[model samples]
Target chain A: MTFLDFAWPSFLAPGRLWLLAVPPLLLAAYIFLARRKSKQGMRYTNTGVLQAVVPPQSQWLRHVTVGLALVSLVALALAWARPFGTDKVPRERATIVIVLDVSYSMEAVDVAPSRLAAAKQAAVDFVNQLPASYNVALVSMSGSSSGRVPPVTDHNIIVRAIEALETQPSTDVGQALEQAMAELDQAPAGEDGDPPPGLVVMLSDAAGTTNPDKSPRQAAKEMGDRGVPIYALVFGTDNGYVDIDDVRYPVPPDFSFFSDLAALTGGQAYAADDASRLADACQKVGSEIGYVEVDKEVTATAAGLGLAFAFVAAVGAVMMGARWR
Target chain B: MAQPAFASPAAAVSSVVTEPSGATIPLSRLAPEAALRRLELTIVRRLEGFLQGDHLGLLPGPGSDSSDARVYNPGQDDVRRMDWAVTARTTIPHVRDTVADRELEVWALLDATPSMNWGTGGVTKRDLGIAAIATVGFLSQQMGDRFGGLIMRPAGLRRLPARSGRTALYGLLRSMLAEPIVPDGTKGPMDLPQGVAQMARSQRRRGLRVVVSDFLTPGDAELDPAHAPAWERSLRRLAVRNQVICVETVDRHEIDFPDVGEILIRDPESDFERYVNTSDEAARLRMNAASAAQRERIRIAIRRSGCGHIQLRTDRDWVQDIARFVLAYRRVAGRLHAPPRGVSR
Candidate 1:
């Protein structure tokens, strides 16, 4: 990326930022001298000859050269402080937990065939796309949440568990998030004895009934505190419904809850009304969680830009100066 | 900063004046007086066929002033001087005796306008012109001969009454040096032409007249040598009854431009201002050519006016230039000043 668009960097030697004051001082001095020179002009006994001889010069060219020189100086001053910018790097160790909603509302056919079928297909695609080295886990949300598969490098086990999830009575998103966090806690540590980076991906149909003591929002907050972010996908449309005992109950998906949960956990939220949209959301989340951000030294890029600007300024100065002889 | 290409040794001496607009130049108190002593000075009025005798008198026989008539001698008295009325009444030739008129008056008109206030040498052009006047005053200071001065500025003309003696000459020089400097863009009815015309009108005498100036008229862009300058008509008129000498003062840098990069060139007497890049060799050459042409035009115009012209550069010693001109003038003074046979005062 170009240095301009690079993240505003952190400085290693911040005290050197004091050098930033030099360019303005230089500009002020230049302006002062230029004004004095214009005011106290060289007097000629006769200007008729000069008028006939000399053509009017492009006065702005000199200012442009000076401006370029000043910009180069500012760049060099910033580079001298030794800056660090955020760089994207692939994580060597990570644990990804997929939570599928298997509530009776997910059995609605608004997402073609059923919401559960679309969720299962998207989850399997997401698991297959992840790096083979990463450990994967699966959890089911029904009357209560439970871990179906523990964190393991074997991706087929998690995919099969996601497909086998059956619809049940209630939607307990809070319980499912708690179970995903538990699975992440049991994950194996790295060679340096630090827990692997973790991400939770949740696919749900509708809002779960309120649990007074611990809501889904509260569980998402706890998951964020444990250094894991949730990427939530809201499946099914507002017209989705389920049938029971000859009574039709409208079970439209609750997008606001998934939006709040994703926001609280520092992750993204997606709403999908069809299987294609669900698959697209799953693909985006897979790519989003694949890398990590770390501060990397970008001093050379800044220095090179400074040198390029300085070189252009010097060339301009020399061209103008040559005629001074 | 790099030194400007046009910077020279002559520019080392700054023109410092006590008056506003850089006027009120001090007298040239340097070594010109000492150096001028060895050179002979003379006004070539006699060669013009008007002053027909030696320095003591002009046409030194019977003067033109009428006196009592007397009987004409047979062979000695000329018929031209005979009183025809008296001769016819008496039927005998009678001649009118006349009183001799003698005394030479010299008037020097110095242009002290704003343009003369500039100099890159030891003295400004105004002060140098004054020095030339002082030199002329010393050269022509005689017992009966009176020396006078006229100072021309943009505002008006100042006259110093003619008087004899070294003290009066010193007084005139002091008044000239005390004249205030005219600020730039000063506008008035008076100009070089008007000033010269006034000198010709007020100072009506048959003697010598000296006009000193840089001869640059403000707002006059005419450069052709064939066309006469605005002041040439007045100068020619002044030269009609009196022998006139024009001392043209100039600065060396006016003709030879130096490489000073970019600079604003301004005219002190006019509102003309321009930025010039002297670094361009081609531009400098063009400027030099134009300036030379300009000076040449001035030289040609003065010559056409039938007056003696001498150029004095601010970069050089004024006294020396005048001395050289005078010495050379002595050799061709008679032949050069001789008017055409049909022309007479």
Candidate 2:
């Protein structure tokens, strides 16, 4: 989901919103009393003589204490509402497997330099953005898919593996998914007898050789059942072309296959033709893989802030030597 | 107990008449008797010699109309007062002198109103009045004069009989110190005018009549043009019979308020309350102007009644103020008593 679409859960104590009216009412009463006090002068033996020596200060400054108190009261009312917000909490551990297409068709220069080069850069950017505690593995898929780097927490090793990739004769999408799942399965189980949350980021043009022994949909179903989501990034535009042996071959990008695979695995699919969209896809994927959402009650924090305001108001009153009416 | 050595009046006066330094010691800090004793010492040590032989005679005495002329001795006779006619006839120097017929009677009309109890300074206006009275009383004693007073208390008028000596004077001071201070908002039976009128009616002696008060009596011409002050007529009466010195006691707070933003002021005697916005510049200015005008009017009233005026403030060193006043009065007296210009006898 987009960042703007993020929503907080409903307040546990919505009825407390009605208490917000107390501060303004108190402020109004204070103002009325202050005005009345200003009108009712102090008792002095000689006002004429006293007026000649003493000058009055600004009226607003005298109300600083009451103003602060009012703010604190408003803060207290907000605290009473028992607000619960959606917080992005870090998972204890996580595993991310980056699958790169090393197929010959990935050499298309529809994007800057070539699609393969752009995909490698996006993979490196994505790994760099992930949390240090996340184990990142790399897989290169062409005629056959292989785990270039076993699942590890060192992002530098994963980045180096992506850079070392070379173009192969054919694409084997089903093999890449199988290799990524194998890398995820190798991660150590947590104390609760469950593996850490896993994510697969596949960067390719979605044009692969068909193999009856391995189906992409079957692989996606297996990963989904195991509670792993695969983020599929389809590179190159629909009008993409590749040059092979001095002859330019039309190899337009196809996203339907990757889109269906991501949908089955409870993940998203993105199509990128340029560096900007590639970076955006990598950033969204990185954030989604690294963090988990949880409901957090902020009542205590709001109460603490309210107390702090109250303390400030009390201190202001004491310092100003303001008398109670 | 060994008796304390008594210094000559002139020597004692010289020692204490120097400009007073520091603040006025509050009565609360000392016992009533001790405070009065300290006041007595201060007054005697500062004013004795300056006022010696300055008492104006009220009756005839041993005369010098050539009737009491005697042969003058060179060392004993006052050379300035040598009788020229007697010297010319007897072929020898002769002098004439006159002795005072009676001791000077000094009376004080003290206003011990509720207003006097208020002071923002080191001491209350009432304390200042007592100090003034002590100063005048001790000075009168040093000059071998009788002292008496009329106190205007919140309860009623208190008449102190004229008596001589330090004991009688201390007794009067002790009584004044013992006088009950009326709290704020208490309605007093008598105002300053009635007190002065009472003094005028009872005390018919020709003496130095001193009136010590804050002089804030309302219904005066200063506050309202149509009405004359209640004390004006009585003060005139006292002024005619006695050498009236209106010692107007003032406090700084009476002239100007401290910068306390808003205050409610209540008149102690009248129980009248007024809320004032001290923060208002215009209001402050107006209050100050009104006070100044009232002071000027009081001065005019004192002048019209043919009485000498001296204002003593609670904030000031009262002894120094009194010394300055006495010195100025002496200068004026010297000027008035000086022989006609170029007419040396």
Candidate 3:
């Protein structure tokens, strides 16, 4: 985000914002009173002679203290409105699931080494980039899907799970996502009644399987209904080839299917020839994934600032020794 | 001839009079009796001892009876008063001297205009003017001479008829002290010269006429010689018949501007206001020069009119200055058989 990008989640009482205009009005009145006071000071009998003896001094400097006090009052008014801004604070009590496809087709050597190897490496890189407070879970899917690592905060366990994945018969993206969600549900609940925000990141070479019982779209619908986003990455090119049982076969990647699945789950879809694009997507997801609007009271802070300004103004007035009638 | 014994025991009093304190006693704030007591203590007692002898003896007199024959000293005795009978008998030059006439009248013309209300010193010019009047009045009372005065205020002229005794002198002094002084409220310029001229016409008696003022008149004798100041002309007319003494009162602020950065000055008599920069050296010098020139003009006018000139300052020991002047006049008078040259009586 740019420097000016910020959010105010909630204002307890936003109606008090109208009071912000009062400082300028009070400043005008203060200026008038100060000028009048200067004019109406002691009346001398021999002003002619007195004028010869003493002249007027600069009055602009005298108003500085009052100006500070007015500004503080404005700040106090803002604090009274109870503003809460969305700050880029550290992510806490969050769970992120990384789903990897270990099907035979993922072994196509189109994206340097093989698609499966590239996915494994991207998964490890994604887990490493996440905030340490986040609990990461690993799930592998082929003919059947299973949770390799339950939701855990240790980076070594998640990395080991990604490295241990082996090639299986076929791809089942829906089962893999369902397994990741099931692991997130089984994980320990946070201090709040509800579980922490959950995210499912699936890395695969979208090769359609003839398994009608488990539909990827239906699975994405379920995750979406649970307010979870499924970020899908297609990791192979159209010119990819795979060898099965000593026979080489051309297995092209279907980017449209994975893109459709990510759209159904309110998430993004990415196509990467190597691990660089996947790594960038992982960093974006880590930064943008989970943020809860928490009410932070700023009344005391603003009032303290206002009081500080008031103290300065008071000290200045005393030092100047102006007649305050 | 033997000099007249004008000495009194009161002459032994210290000539070095202490300067008046800066604290001013506002007469309006005090009761009449209290104010009179303050004036008596502050001004009268200090002057009474030093100036207790005959007031008329300070000036040359025309006596109806001859008193004594004296050897005439050139330039010291008047040629018009040469005694032929004494000269024919003594061979040496002889001049007949006459004792000063009694029943002398002392008239004081006090300028209580709005300008007198201002002073940066301990006392204002008005306060000093009253003190001077008190000194002169008490001295006249001591000499058993009739005392009277004319006060020129911003409102109008006030005249006090000639009267004798201490009570009358105190009453006149109280009136002078009680005159109201308004700040920047005078409607128009005060006609001080006119008032002096009027006073001169009214008090035509051959006596001492003392004029006490700050002398900040608009008329310039050197710049406008054709139309000499009315006061100067009045002084000349008054000097023709009376011993005129001009007690010019001044304040230190009038002589030099203080180093105040800037100021708005308002003329009390004319109600005119002007902004000034006192910190500017050139401006300050210009103001000082103008003040000095104005003072010199007034001095020249008084001197040209052949009157006794005494300057009293608000910041200095005015009583001491007056005493010194009176003593010096007495010493000069004792040395010469006639009044000092150019001095009018």
* Candidate 3 segments whose C-alpha is farther than 4 A from its true place: A1-325, B1-23, B26-100, B188-190, B218-230, B331-345
lDDT of 1 by residue, B1-345 (tens): 222222233432443222234332344452245555556556555322233233533343456657578899989988888899998999988988764445568899998877777776656778778878988777665546688999998889988998877778888888887877777667888999999999999976667889998888665556789988899999888776677889999877766776767766666666666666767888788778877888999998887777888898776766667777888888875555555455553
User: How far in Å is the alpha carbon of B318 misplaced in model 3?
Assistant: 1.2
lDDT of 2 by residue, A73-143 (tens): 87788878988877788776888888898888888888888899999999898888887888889999887
For candidate 2, give the lDDT of residue A311: 94
- Chain A TM-score relative to the true structure, per candidate: 0.80, 0.68, 0.66
Candidate order (DockQ): 1, 2, 3
DockQ of every candidate structure: 0.25, 0.10, 0.02
Which model, 1 or 2, shows the larger DockQ? 1
Which pairs of residues collide in model 1? none
lDDT of 3 by residue, B1-345 (tens): 221122221221110111122214443321233323323211110011112244334323455446678899999889988998889988988998874545657788888766666555556666677777777665545445678888886666788887888788777777776665543445544466777777778875556778888776632223333345557877777666566778988877678766655444444544344444556776667666666766677777877776777888766766566666766665443332223456433
Which candidate wins on DockQ? Answer: 1
Model 2 error, position B202 (Å): 0.4
> How close is every model to the real structure, measured as TM-score?
0.55, 0.42, 0.41
Winner on TM-score between 2 and 3 is 2
